[model samples]
Target: MQTLSTDVAIIGAGTAGLAAYRAAREHTDKVLLIEGGPHGTTCARVGCMPSKLLIAAAEHAHHASHNGVFGVDYAAPKIDGKKVMQRVQKERDRFVGFVLKSVDSFPAQHKISGYATFVNQQQLQVEQADGTQLTINAHRIVIATGSSPFVPEFLKSAGDRLLINDDLFELTDLPQSVAVFGPGVIGLELGQALSRLGVKVVMFGASGSLGPLQDEKIRDYAHAQFNQEFYLDSAAKVEHISHQGNSVQVRYQHRDKGLISESFDYLLAATGRRANLTQLRIENADLTLDDLGVPVHDRYTGQCGQSPIFIAGDVSNAIPLLHEAADEGKIAGDNAGRSLKNAADVRAGLRRTPIGVVFTEPQIATVGLSLPQLKQRGEHCYAIGEVSFEDQGRSRVMHKNIGLLRVYGEQGTGLLLGAEMFGPAAEHIAHQLAWVIQMRMTVPQILDLPFYHPVIEEGVRTALRDLNHQLHIGPEMVEKCLDCGPGA
Candidate 1:
């Protein structure tokens, strides 16, 4: 057995782990980064970059086939599934290579290839692949183990035909038919993409929820828009799943059509992911655990009950987005590195305004506190401003007029709280709203900002204008206000 001591030891050499390493090294030279699996961010390897590559391909194919509405006629474009997957794989590997290069630049002594388990709050036992065991005693520890897809036991009936988002990216060719379970971000994006690329996709969800939208109005609107492209049952009643040779057979209750049986080339499980915590043997760490088995830590400081332990990234189970993970890692690493010198150093870090985006045609986006979050404070505490893209100038001109935008404001202060949007250029619009919310801007303040004429952003102004009226602080919205011009 080998024993080592370090100022800070970070588990999992992914996004948060890498960030933690850099942050901790700024305060102390004795820092170690440990990894059990390959060193690449979830975003680069499986989550964000690869998925976006696939989506990009799907978008091009869809636009090529649907340009007839623009007074331009084109024959249906042939989708070469092999070429699509090849490009996706090639680009995905390139992104992973960049991450690997970064990791390679780190000091060799600071990197350890092993699986770590907690021996105590400040001690870890690492088992290397070459049958070597090492005990690590650190002044502080950060858990950034990340997460994995959670497949229900029932889905195991499909045997080798079952697939997850991780497996989907490894495919060399798109399947002919796919039955996607879970209408969350992964499912909706992949399902829609495959359908657009000439694959028959049927998405099923247990909860009647779409990607990240808490507002029912926006959720329903986005749901309808997606259904127009592919068959999606957000609230599906699935009976059974079984393996049938090279295919998977599914029995489910179809809405308005009663019971139905179907077979697919693969059963794609887009079910939620669980934090990778169990293998660490956290029971020995004497940490307070939540119902989901995650440590109960301070979100601002990333400290676990005033101990030398810190948690970050997807393992924190707070915000699973990549940006949030990076922020949390920096906060946890900075605090962990400085905690031994001064307790005051373990202060709150910068937690940015929340923002989420789903890259589907007529994208989905949420900024700041959602409508449900505001309602939790009290229904009357906030007012809503809404705009339908059905008649928005730019959206109509581009034939992308198919979504809704709802902006929220505090009743008395008229402060912009959050927004949920499903529309053309929603991803860009969400960023603007997030920045405004972070700056604590008010509805009128946002309205005062310059908006370029005849743009999708004008729709945002429309919502803000409506919100201003609802707050009784501005003139009532005029029907086809001449100042706003036609389709404004």
Candidate 2:
């Protein structure tokens, strides 16, 4: 077996692993990056980029079909499914190529193209693709193996007819009809996109909630918007799934609706994701694992137990967004390089104000804290400010006014807390609110900032102004102004 030694060993070559590898390089050149799966970051390969491409195509087709209101009377848009998929793949490959090119700057020897197994806390036995073996010993280790889509046992018999995000993007042709078995982010986005592209899609969720969103107003608005586009049956309990030739049949019972059985060309198992930790051999590391088998590491430090090993990315399961993964990776890499005792001093805290965006017709975005989070922490004294997109002038002009925006702040101090919205350009508004919350700005302080007129942002200003009026500290206090130049 070939033996290798490094200052830090990073597992997986996805986003978090790459970030950790880069950060570890700042401290020492002795770093080994081992990847078991395909190259290119998850966002570029299958998660974000290709999915957005699909959504963009669907949006164009939808707009073209419904342009009668704009005085531009055009025939229904013709969708060449194969061509659309080809374009998505072509562009997706370009993005993956760019990510691969970035990795080319690092020395080839520093990266291992293989699956790594933990022989001990500080040692890994890597098995290369071509029956080669390498033993790597590292002073510190970062587990950024990322995650994989979870499929239930009931769908196992469907085999090739079952699709996940990994295979969905590579489809050469669109299915005539699809049944998506999760109304979460992936399920809702892909389900709506398929419906817009002229495919019959039925989305089923475990609960009435569309996704991870906890707010009632935003969820109701989003659910209503989506129900108008495609069939949605949340509160469904899947009984069984059977494959017959090219199609699959799904049997489920809805809480409101009675027993229902549906057949479709494809079955998409968008039932969330689980961390890739089976090969890590955590027993060797002597870490306390939770019920889900994930290590009980500190969310802030990413340190696993009292050992020199750290965990990051989707594997940590603290927050699974791409940006959060990168940040955690940097923190893990930085802390891994330090002495075990001193690592806690430099440990980074997870961002309290979480931000996540769901790219639908009127995008859904949640920023800062959620109502459930605040209640779980026993801090529920908050007020809300809201505005409907139907009232926004720009939205009305664009013929895309279909959702609502709500902002939350502390009741007494008027400190900005969180926000959830389903509206046009909600992603941008969410980011602005996230920044405001990160800066710990109050409602009046945010209102003090300038707001441009005649834009969708003006809608945000209206919400802030509404919230400012509710606060006790705004528009009611004035300080003395000295007039030195005036003759008094």
Alpha-carbon shift of residue 257 in model 2 (angstroms): 7.6
**Which numbered prediction scores highest in TM-score against the true structure?**
1
Task: Kindly list the per-residue Cα lDDT of model 1 for residues 1-488, writing each as its tens digit.
Answer: 99999999999988898888889888999999999999889999999999999999988888765566778877787889999999999999999999999999998999999999999999999999787999999999999999999999998899999999999999989999999999999998999989999999999998898889899988888888888888899999999999999999999998768899999999999998999998999998999999999999999999999789999999998888999999999999999998879865798999999999999988999999988789899989999999999999989998888899999999999899999998899889999999999999999999889987789999999999999998888999886787887788
Off by over 4 Å in 1: none
**List of clashing residue pairs for candidate 1:** none
Flag clash pairs in model 2. none
RMSD of 2: 5.3
Would you estimate the TM-scores of all the predictions? 0.99, 0.93
Residue ranges of candidate 2 with Cα displaced over 4 Å: 253-258, 340-345, 349-352, 377-380, 469-488
Model 1's TM-score against the true structure = 0.99
Q: How much lDDT does candidate 1 score?
A: 0.92
Q: After superposition, how far is residue 83 of candidate 2 from its true place, in Å?
A: 0.5
Candidate 2 local lDDT, 1-488, one digit each (tens): 89999889999888889888888888888889999878998899989899999999998888775567878876788999999999999999999999899888889878889999888889999999988999999988999999999998877778789999999998998889999989998998888898999999988887677776788878877887788888787766788889989999888885457787888999999998999999878778777899999988877777888778889999887778899998889888878876433645556656557899999888889998897876675555776777788857678777877788888888777899898888899889889999999999998888778765457877776677666665555552221212211110
Candidate 1 lowest-lDDT run of ten: 62-71
